[model samples]
Target: MSSGRMRYAPTSKLFIYSMSTLYVVSPPLEIFEGLKPELRQRIVTLPDFLRYPAGRIKGITRSLLAGRVALPRRILYYWFPKAYFDCLVQARPGDAILIYEACNVRVLRAIRPYLPERVPCYIYYCNPVGTTFRRPAEELQAIRALGYRLTSFDPCEAERYGMACTGQYFRYPEHQPDNIDSDCFFCGLPKDRAGTLQRLRTRLEAEGLTCDFVIPRTPAEKLTYPQYLDRLARTRCVIDISQKGQTGLTRRPLEALFYGKKLLTDNPEIARYDFYRPQNVFILGKDPEEQLRAFIESPLAEVPETVRAAYDVNEWIRHYLP
Candidate 1:
C-alpha cells in the first residue's frame, strides 16, 4: 500500500491499447458527465439497476439480506445476470475496465474469469473501507485476487488497503459567482452526529452568523447533486464534518477551493495538504467557535490555478484512465 501522494499517469502503450473501455459505475450518472468527450465516447457503462423500478426493488432487497446474511462472493452474478453477461461478452483484450466503488461485487467476480489477461482492470473506492453496506473486506480482497488495480479517495485507507489513492475530483462549473448569501453552509446525513451538528449550528447562530445547516431526515429532503452544488455556490464558507475513522479529504474542501469559498472542517489532516491555507481553511478542534468566527471574518485567499486544476475531474480522469 503506497501513499496516495504518488501520481499515476497513463503510459503511451496504455493510450494506444485502450481504444475500447467498459465502465461499471454506480448510480447517479451525472457525476461522470465532466469526462472528456473522447474518453466518454470510448467508454460503455453497464446497466445501473438502481435506475429502474424492478432493479431498485432488487437492490433494496439485497441490501436488507446483506445486513443479515453474508452472501457468497459470486451471488451478484445471479442477482444481476444481465450485467454479468454484458461484461463478459463486451470486454476485449487490451480494453480498459473501470469499476467505481466496488459497488457491484458480483459483477466484478463474474467478469473476472472472462477478462482478457492483457486487459487493464481498475477499481476506484469512493467510500472508506469497512463503511460500505456490503461485504467490503471480502469484496476488496476478491478484487485484489482478481488483479484489479485498486484506488481510493482516502490516502490513509489507500495505504491500509495497499491501493493507489486518487483524491476526490469535482466538475468545474461553467460559472461561479462571487456573491454569497450565507456565511456558512452544510447539508448531509447526520450519521449519528446530529446532536453535535445541531449544537454547532446553535453556537454559530448565537454569534449572529447565517448558517444553512441541513440534516435531512427523509429522502425527499436530500438535495440532488446539482442542487447541492448550487447551495454551495451561494455560501461564503463550507463546513465539513468527517465521518468517524475517515482521514481522507472529501469533495467538500475541493468544492470550496473551486468556488472560492472558505472551509471549516473537522478533518485536521487537511492541514498537511499543499493547498491548505490557514486563512482559507480552519480545522475544528479546541475553541472551534473562536476559530470559526475568525475564519468567517477573514478574507478568502486565492487558491493557485494549478492547485484547483489538480482536483478537476478532467485531470483525475487523465491520471486514472490515461
Candidate 2:
C-alpha cells in the first residue's frame, strides 16, 4: 500500500510522512491497543527471542561469549538476526518503524543493513538517565548516526542524550464515570519506595480517608490496564510515586487529567508544567498528611480542554507516527 504525507503546519517546512505499516520492536504492551483502527491494523509486534527454546539457548551462548570478553554484547546482533530481518525486509518505502528502549540495540543493528532507505526509523526511551537499564551513550550515538530519529518522554533526559523530546501520551477513555467513590488510589511495583508508600497509606487510613493502594507482590497480582483505569476512574484523587532519578511525566498525571481526578505526587518538577494547578495537583513533601487532608476536602478543578487535547492519544499518535 502506498503511504501519504501529512502536512502539520503551513509555516513549517517539515512534512510528517504517513506509514502504511508500523513495525513495533518491543515486548508486548497494552498501550498498543489504544492505537487508531487504521494504524492498529498495520501493527506488527515483535516477539521476545529469549522466550523460545532455541532462542534461549542462543541467548545463553551469547552471554557466555560476552562474559569471556570475546564479543561485545551490543555487537552480538548476528545471533538473533532472523526476527530483525523479517520485519526490516517487509518495511516498504514510507513505512514507519519504532523501537522502544535502547535494549533493542542488537535488533536495530541487525536490521540496519536491510532497512529501506526511504523508511523512517524511530527510537523511544521511556526510562530516565543514569540507570543501568538505559542505553549506552555511544550506542545511542551510533543509532543516530544511522539516521534513526531518537525521542523520549523525558524532555530533559532527551536533551542530555541529544534526542528529540516527544513527551508522553495516554489513551483517552470513550466514557468518563461521574461518580467517584474512593478518596485516593495508587498501583505499582513497590520498588525502593515500599517503606515510603506504606507510611503514606497508613497515614491516609489513620485520617479515615479511603486509599486504595496496591503494590503487587508477584507478576500475577499486577492489575491489567483496563482494571487499573477502572480504579483510577472510581477515585477522587490519584497518587504518583515517581521512581528514583525520574524527571519526566508518567502516565498517572495524564490519567488524572482525563478522569478529572486530583493528583498527589512527590515529583516537584511537575509544578513547572503549564497544566499544573495547586487545586488539582498536590506535591508530596514535609507534612504530606496535612497536604493530603486539605486536598481531599477541596473540590476537583477542571483542566482546560486545550491542555487535555495536547496529550490525547490521537494527537500523540499523529505526532509520533505522522
Candidate 3:
C-alpha cells in the first residue's frame, strides 16, 4: 500500500490516476457520485453480503448485473481471498483506491509490504465505535499511526476524533434518508411510552412549563418531512436532548437548524459545535427548571431570522463540507 496524496480537478483531468477501479464498502452513494466522470465510468460495487448462499446471492447479483436491480456502481468481495490480495499487489501505481472500513484497513495494513508505496488510502469514519471522548487514550493513539486521512459522515464526530488526537478529520456530506419527515417537531418514540421519557416529562411538568407535547412512536405515527418541518414552524422552541447523555449535537439539533427552530437541550457539550452558543441555541443544565421557565416566559417570536439561519444546512455545507 503506497502512502501519497493525489489531487484532480473535475474539468481538465478526470481519472488521471492509472487504475480506475474504486471500491466503496459503505452505504452513502452521495460521496462518490460526485467523482469525476471518467472515474465513475469504470467503477464496481462489492456487495457487503456475499456468504449466505450461492443460489440466492449469485442469483441476485446476476439480476443486478443483468440490470434487473438497481445498485450503486461498486463491488464487494464476499470472502477474503489470496486472489484479492494478489490483485491488490498487481494493481498499477496511481490506482485511485479507497477502503472505508477498519477491518479492510487492517487487511490492507497486513499486506502493506506487498502494495506499492504511493496508493492514496482514505479512511471513512461513521463513529468512534467504542471510545467516548471521556475515555479515549488507547484508541486515539492507534488511529493516528494508520497514516490515512479520515473522512466522516458527522462533522461533530470528526471534531471529537480530532480532540482525541486521531487523523485529520474531514466532513463528507451525509446521506440523510428521505424517510425522515423534516416538518415534525418530535421524531423518535414518545417519552411517555418509553417509561424513561414519561419520567422526564413528569419532571419537566413538575417544573411548570406546561407546553403541549407530541410523541410519534411507530412508522405510522411519524410525520412526513414536510409535516415535521411545519410542526417546527409552529413551535417557539424545539428540544434536542440525547438519550446518550451530554455528547455531540445529534441530527436532531441539525434538524432544528434546518427548520430555523430555537433549541433548548440538556446537552451542554453541544457548545463544541460551531454556531452553537449563539442566540439561536440554548443550553440547559442538569436542573433545566429555571432556564426552561425563563425561556418559556421570554418572547421567543422576537428572536431574529439571522439567529435562526445559523443552523441552516446551506451554511453548514459552506462552513463544514466545502
Candidate 4:
C-alpha cells in the first residue's frame, strides 16, 4: 500500500487530505475482509472485471498473445467490465488507486487512457519477483513511464528493484481463535518447496505434532482463503515457508501473530519485527529442535489486538493515501 497511487473522486482534484479514500485493484484474492467496512467498498479484483475467454482455445490464445501483441492485449483488456473503469474515469484527482503488482503493465497500459490526471497510481508487490513474478526491469520502467510508483512488501526485493519496502500484511477478522484440531498448519503451492514441506511435516509429526500441511499442486488447486483460515484457526502453529529465494515476512507469520498461533518459519528476518517473540516464533533452521518442541508445547503468547489491527489493510492504505 506504500506504493503511490492516483485516485480521483466525485469532486475537486485538490491537495491530499488526511481522509482521502483508497481504491485497490489486485489479483483474485479476497483480502479486504479485515479492513474497516468503508474501506472494503473501494477494492476491486481484476480477474473478475476482465473478460473470460469462452473456451479453452481462446483462453490459450489470449494467454499466448496478451504478452506479445500490444494491440490484441489492449483490445482484450479494453473489453474489461465497463463499470470498474468508469469508477476510475469519474474519480477525482484527489483519490488514490492501488494496482497490485500482479496486474501486468499491459493491463496498466490499457487503463492509462482512463486514468485521471496526476491521480496517484501505485504498483505494489505482495510477492517477490523471480519467485512468483518474472516481471523484467523494463516493466517497472514502463510502469513508471506511465506515472505509477513501485513498491514491494519484501525489503530485499524492494532494495534489489529500487522499490519502497512496505510491510506484508494479513487482512483477517479480529477475534480469538477457539478451535484446536491440529498442532501445525500450512497450505500453499509446492513451488519447489514440496520436499521441504514434506520433510518438515515428518519432523513435526516425529515431535508428536499433528500437522495439516496442504501442498496444492497449483494455484487453482489451492484452498480458499476461508478454508485456509479455518484450518489456521484449528491449529496451534502456522508454517511459514518462503518461496526458494524469498526471505520476506509472509502472511503465515502475520496469521500466527494475529491468531495467537505459534510461528514455525524459515524466515529469520521476522526477528526484526516488533511483534516477533522467540517464545511464539521458532526459526526453522536457526532454532534447535528442542526450542521448536518447546515453542510448540508452550501456550501461544498474547499479541495485543491493537498490534494486530495495525496490519489492517485500511491502516496500510492510509499510509500511502494520506
Candidate 5:
C-alpha cells in the first residue's frame, strides 16, 4: 500500500513537456518515502490479482489471448484494475510518466492509447536487467523505437542498452533503530548468494563480529518488510554482497545510510558515489577480514542531509526528465 508503481499509458511519441505530477508504474515495493505526500499517492501496484484465487486463471487467460490470438486493446483492457483506468484517464500532458518492472509492460501495451498525446515515458531498471527482465532484445527495441526513455542504476546495463544511467532511491521509516545486538545483518531471497552469505557469516564470526544472515529457501521463509527492518534495527551494520559481477549499488547501502549504520558491500561502484566514506563502508574482496572488523568498529561517518536527500525517489524522478 505504501509504495508500488502506478499504471501507465504507452510510450508512443515524444512531447517536449514537463509535469509536476509524476505517474509511476512499478512492481510493489515499500520504499516510496522520498516523495511528497501527493506524489506518493500516485503509485500503483502491478500484477494486481483478483480477490479470489480463481481470478488468477483470468489473468493467465488474458496474457495468453494477448500473445496468441492478438486480442485487441479495446477488449483486453477490461482485465486491468480500475486504478489503471483512472491513472490513464486522469493523467494530463502536464504529468511526468515512468514505468518499472518488466511484468507491467503488458498492461501498458494493453491500454496504450488512452494516455495523453505525445507524452514521453521513462522506464527505470531498479534491479539488474537479466534478473528482472526476460523479454528478448526485439521487445525492448520495439519499446525504445516507440520513444520511451530507458534508464537504469547499473552502469553496465546503461551501456548495454543505451539507457540513461540513473541513481537508486530509498526512504527509511521514522522507526528508530533498536539496541544493536549484532555487528552486521543481511536478509534476502537466496538466489545463488546463499553460500557466499554463509561464508561471510563464518568469516565475520571468526573475526569476533556477530552476523545475522537470513537467506530464505522458500517463499514462506521470506521476511516481510517490517520483520526485515526489525532485524536491521538490531545490527550495527548491514551486509550487501551482490551476485557475482553485479556492480550497481542496491538498496543495502541506502538502508545503511538512512539507518545510520555501516555497510559491507562488494559493489566497487560505491566508491564512486558522493556518500562513500572509508570509515562507513567496507567493500568485500577489497577489505581483508581484519579490515572489515575494523570497519565494523569504526565510527560511522555522517552523511549530510543534502547528500541523503539526493537519493530520494522524488529526486530520482526529477533527474532523468528532459
Candidate 6:
C-alpha cells in the first residue's frame, strides 16, 4: 500500500530572498518567551566566550566552533558582546541584529567597519548613570560618539549623560494584594556595612518598632522573582533608603507602589514619578522615627483606582515594542 500523507507533501519551498530575520542579542530568556515563543523557537544562543582573557577574537572563534549547532532562519544571539558584530555582519542580508546594552559604544564603533550597511541596530538599556558611566571620561566620550538609539527607564539619566533616548524602558506591572498580611517594617540592609543594620534595628526598637525585619543574610541568599512579589504583598509599607550613591527610586518604591503599600524613600526626585503621592509614598530624611511611628500606627488604604489605571504594563510594552 502507498503512504498517501508522505507522498502528497513537499518539504521544501521555492527560494525567496525577501524574507525577514529578526535578531535579538543578549536578551533575557524570560522576555524572549513573553514576546513571541514561536520566534524564540528560531533563536540561536551565542556562547559566553567573551568571558575569555583574549577578548573578541577568541570569543568569536569559540562561537564559530560552537556553531556546529543548527542556526535558525530568523537568528537571535543572546548577550553577545561587541566582538560578535563581525559574525553578525557576515550573516545573510535579510538577517536582523539587536544590541541589548548601550554601554558598549566603543565595541559598536570598532565593528563600524563590518556593520551591514542597511541593517538596523536596536538598544534596550536600563542603567542608572552612576553605574554605567563610571568608567574613565575618555571611554564615556567614546560611547557617546557611537550614537546608538536608546531605551531607558529615566529620561533624566539619559539627558545627564548627554545621550538622546528613543523611548522609555518598559517593565512588568505591579500586582498588589487587597489585604495587608503583617504589621512590620521591611528594609533591605546593606550586606557590606558591618553592624549598620544592627545599630538601626536597636534605634527602631528604642522607638518601639521592634522587629529584626526580613533582610537577606548571605551572598547566596536570593529570593525568586515570585517570592520577591510575595514579600512586597505581605508588608504594609517599604522603607526605601539608599545609604550610598545617587538616590533614585530603586526597585523598592515601584514594588511598594504596586503592592498598594506606603513607601518611605529618601530620594526627593521620586515625587516627579506617577506612582508617588502623599497617601502612598512619604519622603523622609536620615531619621524616619517620627514618620515611621505615624505610619505603623495607621497605614494608608489601597491605592486609588485612578492612580492604578495610569500604571498599566500594556501601555509600556506597546511603547517599547512599537
Alpha carbon deviation, residue 191, candidate 6 (Å): 7.1
Best candidate per TM-score, number? 5
Candidate 6 per-residue lDDT over residues 171-273, each given as its tens digit: 3433455765654445464644336555655755666764536677775575665665676677666766554444344556766655556776667777777
For model 3, the superposed segments whose C-alpha errors exceed 4 Å read 1-76, 80-119, 131-147, 150-184, 188-196, 203-236, 243-246, 272-274, 277-279, 286-322
TM-score per prediction, in order, is 0.80, 0.79, 0.47, 0.81, 0.82, 0.62
Candidate 1 has an lDDT of: 0.70
In candidate 3, clashing pairs total 23
TM-score of 3: 0.47
As a whole number from 0 to 100, the lDDT of residue 188 in candidate 1 is 92
RMSD of each: 7.9, 7.2, 10.6, 5.9, 6.0, 8.8
Ranking by lDDT: 2, 1, 4, 5, 6, 3
Q: Candidate 2: where are CA atoms >4 Å away?
A: 1-19, 27-30, 38-55, 61-85, 132-135, 176-181, 286-289
lDDT of 3 by residue, 51-77 (tens): 222667655654344222332323333
lDDT of 1 at 249: 90
Whole-model Cα lDDT of every candidate shown, in order: 0.70, 0.71, 0.45, 0.70, 0.69, 0.50
Where is model 5 more than 4 Å wrong at Cα?
A: 1-20, 27-29, 38-60, 67-74, 103-108, 320-322
- Candidate 2, residues 73-93, lDDT tens digits: the string is 345544644544355555787
Model 1: which ten-residue window has the lowest total lDDT?
A: 8-17
Winning model by lDDT: 2
TM-score of 4: 0.81
* Residue 40's lDDT in candidate 2: 59
Selected candidate, larger lDDT, 1 vs 5: 1
- Candidate 5 lDDT for residue 151: 80
Candidate 4 off by > 4 Å: 1-20, 27-30, 38-78, 172-177, 218-221, 304-306
